[model samples]
Every structure is written in C-alpha cells, then in structure tokens.
Target: MTSRVLIAVTHLLGVGHLARAAALARGLAAAGNEVTLISGGAPAPLVAMDGVRLVQLPPVHIVGTAFSALLGSDGAPAGDTIMEERRRLMMEAVAGLRPDVVITELFPFGRRVLADEFLALAGAARALVPRAAILSSVRDVLVVPSKPGRLEEAHARLLALYDGVLVHGDAAVLPLERSWPVAAEIAPLLHYTGYIDDRPVTPAGEGADGAGEIVVSGGGSAASLPLFRAALGAARSVAGHRWRLLVGRGVPEEAFAALAGEAPAHMTVERARADFPALLARAALSVSQAGYNTVIDIVRARVRAVVVPFEAGRETEQRLRAESLAEAGVWPFAVVPEAGLSAQALAQAVTQTLARPLPPGAAIDRDGVAASVALVACFAQARCRRFPALSRALDEVAAGGGSVALWWRDDDAVAPTPALDRLLSLAAKHALPVAIAAIPAHATQALADRLAGEPLASVLVHGLSHANHAPEGEKKAEFGPHRPLAALCKDAAEGLRRAGETFGAPLLPVFVPPWNRVSDDLAAQLAACGFAGLSAAGKATRPDARRARGLAIAHTHIDPIDWHGGGGLLPLAEIDDRAALAVRARAAAGGEIVLGLLTHHLAQDEATWAFCDDLLAFLLDHPAVVRADARRLFREAGEEEAWCAA
Candidate 1:
C-alpha cells in the first residue's frame, strides 16, 4: 500500500507553500512511501529535505507584488525559453516517476501565470497506464480573486481535472468558504488536513535566547519592510522592554544592513532565526505579520501576540486569517491593520497585548502531518479498489459487447441535516445522480433551497405522512390496504402535488411507499394518481404486467446498511458478495437490469458513509457501468420498455 507520490510546488514571493510541501513529503516518506518533491522556486536553505527525493527546476519568482512579471534567478524577466525549459523538466519528472498520486501546490487557485505547466503535468499524470490521482494542495485561506471570470476559470479547472483538494487547515477554525466564493460547489472534494506544523514544542523556560524580549518577524519574504521600519521606530516608544527584530531572507542585504545600523541600544536586528519557535516559547510577546507558518508557530508557542497583516497589493488573505483567528479567541491576541501602521499604533497594540492574560493551551488541531498522510493513503487505497469485484463483473459484460446501467436512491429525506449534506456531497463528488425519496408532509422549503445548487439531485414523493396504518402483527405500510382506496389515492396525488410545488423541475413523478411496501390495490392506483414510476425494494415483480398497466417499475437491489444488526455498516465482504450476485443477475437478465443501490442517510454512521463513498467511486470508475439518471429512467409512463429496448 506504499504509493509513489509526486508533489509539485512553486513559491512566488514567500516560501510558505514550498515549506508546507516539504513537510508533507517528509511525512509521506516517513510512512514508507516513495516521495518525490519538485520545487519550481529558488532553493531555500532552511527547508528540510530529509528522506525525500528533491528535484529543482530553473527557479522563477516575482519581484514585489508584480505577479504579471515573472523573474528568473538572475532577476530579469523570464523569457519563453526559460518557461519552456521549466515545463520540459516538470513533464520529464512526471513521466519518469509515474507516481500513483500527483499533488500540485496552489495551482489553479493562485498561480495563474504557470497554468500551462501545471495543466501539462496533470495531463501527463492522466496519460499514465494507471492514471495518478491528481490533487490540489492549498492553504486555509486563498487570496480572493477580484478579476471577472477568474473564480469561474479556477472552478472549471478543478471540476475538469482534479480529484480532490487538500486544505491544510481546520474548517471549524477558518472554513475556505469564507474566502473562496464557490466553495459550496466543490465542497465534496475538500479535505481539511488541519494546520501543517512540524515544529517541536519548546517547554517553558527552555528558550533563554529570547526569554524576555519582544520578538518581531515577517515571514520568509521581503513583504514586511514597512513593518520592520515601523517596529524600529516603535522600539524607542515602547520601551522598558528589549526589542529583537528578525528580518526575512528575501530582504536585500543593504536593507538588512540599514535596519541593523538604525537599531537603538535596547534593540537587536538579525536574519530570520532557524529556532524562531523556540524563541517565541520564552519571549514576552510576539509581533509579526499574519502568515500560515508564522501563525502556526505563534499558536504553538502559546505566546501573547499582535498581528499586523500585510495588506499591500489588495492581498486579503493575511488580513482575513488574522481577523478570524483574533475573533475566535483561541488565544489572547490583537490585530493591527497594515494600512496605516505606524510607531504609535504598533507600540500601543504591543503594550496592550502584553497586558492580556495568556490562555492555558492551544485548542487548534495540530496533527496535520499525520492527518495529511492518512488522507493521501486513503485516497490511494480507494483508487486501487476502483475496479473491485463488481466492477470486474461489469468489465466482463463490456468485453462481451454489452453494458450495465446503475442508479442510486436514498429514502426518508425530510429536512436538510448534516447527514443529508454528506449524502448529496457524495453524489456531487462522483458526478452521479441520486433520487431522494422525500416524505412530502415533512419536507421543508429549506431542503428545497439547499438543493437549488445541486443539479445532480432529484426528488421522489414518498407516501404522505410516512405513517403506518397497518394493524397489529402486520408489516408496516403507509399505502397499504388498511385504508380506503379513495383515501390512499387522494394521499398519493396530494404527495405528488406537494413535492412538485417544493422541488419544481427536480421533482420526479414517482411513488415510493413507506418501508418499501405497498399493497397490490394501491400499486394499481399509482398510475391514476399521475405517477410515471413505482420504486420499491428488491426486483420488480410482474414488470411487463405493470408496464402494460401504464406504469414503469424500478427497484433498489442492494442496501449496504445492516438494519437488523444495530444499524451499522454491513461488512464490506458481505456487501461485495451481494453486489456480485446483483451484477450476475443483471448479466443473466439480458443486461436490461438497472442495479439500484439504496441508502438512508439518517441511519448512516461513519463506517456506512465510507462504504457508500467507496461504492460510488467504484461504480463511476468502471468503464462498463453507465449511471442512469432518474429523470431519464422514469420520464414517462410505460417508458421502461423504451429504456430496456436500448
């Protein structure tokens, strides 16, 4: 189960992206996987490369915030020749490694200038014999695109090419939706891996180097020159305490020399330290720009701090992270906006931040390295099992010049809950349609509103009220013979009408009985109530007879939950056995059978959810399995014949 993984990362102005990619490579390599990390930016001496195969392309970077102008290592505009060379090197690495998974860091989302190379890498990965699972690696918050159609372009690229996006932060802390506008459309593919922090925890009293000094730093970029100058000016005003300023590596040598010379007697300025986290552990207070790696270090150190986020060039990412974290009150902190930063404002913020009481410990999830590794492994395992026994059976059908159709249905949807969201997310993720049997009496407008964005979901009318009228010692049934024929027919018609009003075009004129049971008398009356189809559990009984009576019947063949065994997931082996039987039955029946997979989201646990996700992925990957859309399956009365004939 050791997968070959290739991670491609390019740092334009800061080294945060490359730093995170390096952490992931180390974690994956430590877990016994063959990991190759390809860097497209200037090499950094601080990033660790232990246990990873490193490939460096001709480095390209941007000066200041001029992202439109790409500069080479020689500080000149990178011409067409250099760009072609970079693409060639990247393609060569991808073709040679033949990795099982390809991870692109912040491409499609941030690096629009390099789309050609990243797109080529994705195409090359897909062209491999066993196509690699392509994923986008991104930070918690992205720089919101202001240009028209930029968001649309990125979203389109993701839907067309990527398998999933690994978000390296917790959703509860800072959900990507707060920054990315189209997050809901791609919610199914987002996997939050917590915050990626590999720094060792320094205990109290362990960092004597910065024991009682006010430590100030900008991340590994020159984006904080103004902040450093303001800090120098603030040192004289904020005064009884000693000040220590750490300049980033991207700062010019002359700039560093000037800052060092201008320092007062109580102030010290130096290059960014390798042991900054240790320094923060014992520092009196931390004052720095709000960047991913910097915030993580501050949070890990449990130090009182003031964050002055870099807001130049309309960059809102740092400001958003700083404000959100301050609002979360995870720890005592202050946010000083960089727009009008000066010595007085920074001095006041720093002094006030020092007066606040420190929290006992951090509340954020910091196991990102392990969590990211596990997520990648899970994705790889799922990909390997994409052609399971059921899929193989369909392959045989395809080899014999035939194909099999499959559809999904979930029952008892009444409202929009977390479980329902998960169910719809799975459908969206696999690009498959799912027919939701909604209890009309309890269905809410909120549920209808939620489905407005999900074009792949359709609704079917469950029995009115979903209430049982059967007598004691009898099986539960809502549309059973216990009620008058007129009453049953009226309820069926009313249910269809209510569902139509709520769901509009997404509503299918189908009747689903409660507990998957309906009396023969009521079944005969469904066509009269304007229902084009009748769906229940197991095989359709007397299908030809039903079609002759102006009704098409489609029944779900497999349910992966153990309803009688404590409502947990049925063993995968048992599910696989049942699926094999279903496929065999479909093949024996002239390949006209549409294999139906049933689920009840309300009753599903984590194990059941995982099984369903895997099942859908398996079905989608098989070349011979055609996913039948519910609308097409039951578009008209007696349409089953036309569908079966095809």
Candidate 2:
C-alpha cells in the first residue's frame, strides 16, 4: 500500500529530533512509501534523503516573547513578509497534496520553536485531508523541565493533536517515566520503535590513512578554540610520535596562528573538515566534546577519546551522556570533564588516551536492524489483516516418557516411493505426529498442504529463509553488514508470514539461522525486531518476556536436537551416550534442561528409532527430567510470571 507521509522536524536545542526523522524517512521511503521532510527550522545536512521530497518554509527562529523576524544571513530584520509567504505556501501545499500521514517531530513535547506552525499544519491537514494519521516522533530522553508543570502542558498539547507518539527506544530499557514524571497517562499514545538509523560507521581501512599518530578537535567552529590551543601547548611537551590535529569549528584563530612555532617539528595541525569518522578510525586518540551523536560515531569507529563534556551550566546533557557512555563500556578509553579542557589537563588526558589501548568494541547485532524491519513489516501486515481478534487452541497428544514424535519420508523428499500400508504401519508406531522444518518458497506451503489440520509436533518457518552462507563472517542472512539488510529480512519475513497464515499455527518465528553461527551484530539486530525468540548460537538475557535472535531472545539456552539437521544420522551407541550425558546434566541443573531436536525423515532408520527408545527409558527413570516446548519454556521463563505475580 502506498502512503503519503509528511515529517516535520525542529532542532531548537539539538539535532537529535531532525536526525531521527531523517532516518525514519529513509526507512519509510525504502518501504516504497512517499515521504516528505518539512523543515520548520535549520536541520543538519546529514539528514538528506534520495526518494523523499524535501520541503522548506522560510526558516523561523525563537527570540524571547513571541518569535523575532528571521533573516536569510542579510542581517536586516524582515517583518511578516516571510511568515505570510511561508504560511500561504504551507496551507496551499497541505490542502493541495493532502498527505496520508502527518508526523510532527518534537513540537508537542520538546521543541516549541515551530509549535504554532506545526499546530497550524495539523489543523489544515485534518480539515482538508481528513484521513491522515497524525504522529509525533520523539527521542528516548526528554530533558526534565525546571518548572514541573511545563512538561505536563506540553504532553497535553501533544495528546490533543497527535494520534500516536513514536518513541525511538525500548520502554523496558528507558521507560518514558524516567524522563517524564507523568508517564502513566501518556502510555496509551506511545509506540516504542527501536532506534531507527542508517548512518554507517567508517570502515577500519579509512582510519589508517596519513600515518603520524592523529588527534581530532571538533565542536561547532565556535567552542573549539580552547581545546585547539591546549592541544597545541601540550604537543610542545610530548616528544616521540608525530601529532596531527584535525581542527573542528572550535579552534581559536590565534590557536592556529602559532601552530608552526608552538608545535614540535614533527607535529602538524590543520583546520577542521567533515568525514570525522574516517579520521577517527585512523586517529590514535581524540580530545572532544561529548555530543551524543559524535560519541556514538566515536565508539563505533573505535577511537580512544578523552571526553571533555560541553557544560551547558546546570544542564548536564553532555556530561551525563559521556559518563553514561563510559559506564556502558562504549568509551573505555577515558573521560576528562568540561572544566579540565585546559592546556595541561587536555595534554595529560591526550597522553593517557594515546598510551592506553583502544577499548574492546561494542558488539553490533547485525541482525538488529533486519529484525526490526521484519517486525515492522509484520505489524504492517497485521494492520492490514482487519480481522477482529481471534484465538485457536493448541493441539497436544502425549506419548510415553513425556512426549515423542517421529516422521517418515513424504513425496517431497528425493527417496524411493513407499506403499501405503508399509508407510502407515511405521508412522503409526514410531512417528506419533509430524514435525516439518518448513523452508520458505521450497518448503512451507507444501508442508501446510501435506499435513492440513493434522496433529503435528511443530511446523516451523526456519531462519526467515534457507539461502545460507554470508560474507564478512556472518553465517545468517538476518545479520551482516550487507547493503539494505533490513529490506531483505522484511521480504523474507513477509514470505514466512504467508506460511503462518497457511498453517494457522505460530509458524515458529524461531530463527534456525542457516548455520548455528551468528555474529554479535546480527543477534542485537534481531532483538530490536520484536522477535518472540531466536533459536540461535547462545544464551539470551531477558529483562521481561524474551530477547529475540541474539539480543531480544528471552531465555537464551535450549536445544532438543529436534532442530535442523543434515541427512546423516548419529550411530545408535553415540546417540545413547549423548542422551546419557544430557540426562545427567539435566539432573545436575535441578530444574529442566532444554535440548533442541534434529529430526530428519529422509534419514529415519532402525538405529535412530532405537536410540529414541533408549533415551526415553533414561528420561523415565529421572523423575526430575521434563520435556518442554522451546517456545513455551522461553515465554514462561522470560516474563518471570511466577515472580511477578508474587
């Protein structure tokens, strides 16, 4: 379905709001939705998009009581001329184009710069368009207002105007209440979408260019002067390695005046330019202000930094952000507070940062972005389903020693044809029910048709898709630095969803990633996607329900050998021994041990069936041993239901 989206962005105090909106626009556009970025104030150059249209009004600025007339760098004050022109254009565009969705950024909650304009836009959109979905995009953190009641008023305005609020963070991690004191009432309008961003970290190769141990100095050409001077003064004392400083907007004019004279012969200082990540990737160390966006890039690029947090007085956004980042282990390198950006202080911090080894990098859940995309796609499809809520009972048929199921070859397998009687006899005795590993395109619909309404152990849509093997050490398609990985996963998810509709079961969102191998980045990506759980390589940490893939998976450990397997079967003796050890391990753990199963119908033999009997005998003797559905165990354990109710 095509969607017409209008995104309004205002950056009164910082660029976060605008930046996030830009990222959302990219995602929306990539999904083939028409997106228009409406600028109410100056936004960063980084938020530009290809397919999305950029519409700008004559920019306005806030100055004391009401807004002062804004100028286009001419310095002369222009009256209602610009405002009238912009208002006329804006209403005309809204009435004429009539967008399907109007997303206002930060006005109702954070930015009051363009509150009037956005409110006008909203009124115009509703009166003319009638069917537009009104949304407000906000950051995870909201600065606590000095006068306690201001936020409540702002939130009320938001509640009155916007249909929904898209918060780009998890409520479990940083709940709205943490920032806004009155979060309970606001909960109804909130939609916690994981952070949406497209900026790529600089590749490791770029940092190696222009050798001589480098350091970067950047803070909007206005505040960087002191750091530059301090860095220059420090270079005079530090000997050995040559120092090259990439000066940002902060350097004082005089700091560069004596760069040649103040610095040792080997050290070089140059004026700042963009492409900071590239320099950071190569730099030995950096002494910089703690801007949230820059800090993320610094951590991603693996640069050792001495954080001289910009102190906006009692407003400690930068200071708090830097401290929290270090605590999170992002910048393990070091931190130098705002007051300590002086010559000796900066030089000392720089020396320490350079001497110290770079911090162990943050694991990227390559699957995080992909899984999030898939989750959104699922939500979109669910949105379209239009069916009133419905529930179906789960079927269960127990066998001896807990539960056991087996299956023999079906027509899809490349095997000899079996007569009806022989197949029925074997299936009746050995395979209690069906367990099909439904591979998409080649597998799902077939399994659904073959076993429609039949009792089955489980029918799983495996790993989004079966196409395996990836470059850059990623064994799963859902994870990797692959171009547009989100798009790929979303497509695959759509396919799996169709399979679920056909089978009428949960259809297993469990990710049997082609190879049991998954990179940390991939795992994190899946967690953000709202996957119920991921049956991947490691244990998952759960705060509430479950963590999916690697990051979102609730209770990480479980396997029944009932998972995907090759045609090869374990010898009877080996299977017995493996089961024996598994039994002992479960007894030791004292509760229940989950073992993933790998059943292959194509390779069913007497030896395999016999091994199952032996394991059953052992399981029966150990009264503590329990058989569990991996999905069920995960859900029950993740929500901490027993503990929470108490």
TM agreement with the true structure for every prediction: 0.65, 0.51
Which candidate's TM-score is highest?
1
lDDT winner: 1
Q: What lDDT score belongs to each candidate, Candidate 1 first?
A: 0.82, 0.51
Residue 594 C-alpha lDDT in model 1: 74
Writing each residue's lDDT as its tens digit, candidate 2 over 585-626 gives 333333333433344444454334433333332332234334
lDDT of 1 by residue, 1-646 (tens): 8999999999988788899999999999999999999999988888998899999999998978898899999999999999999999888898888998999999889899899999999878866645678889999899867899898779767755677899999888888888887555467678899999987998858447788899999987888898999999889898888899999788889999999999998999999888888889989999998889988899999888888988888899888987787677665568889887998999999888888788775488778889999988977766534225665667778798877678899999989999999898778777789999999999999988887778889899998889988999898888877989999999999999999998888888988888888877777778889988878876422222224246676778779888778887665556666776777766776636577889999998755675676567667667777888888777634433422210
TM-score for candidate 1, please give it: 0.65
Clash count for each candidate, listed in order shown: 0, 41
Record all residue pairs in model 1 with backbone atoms less than 3 Å apart, i.e. clashing. none
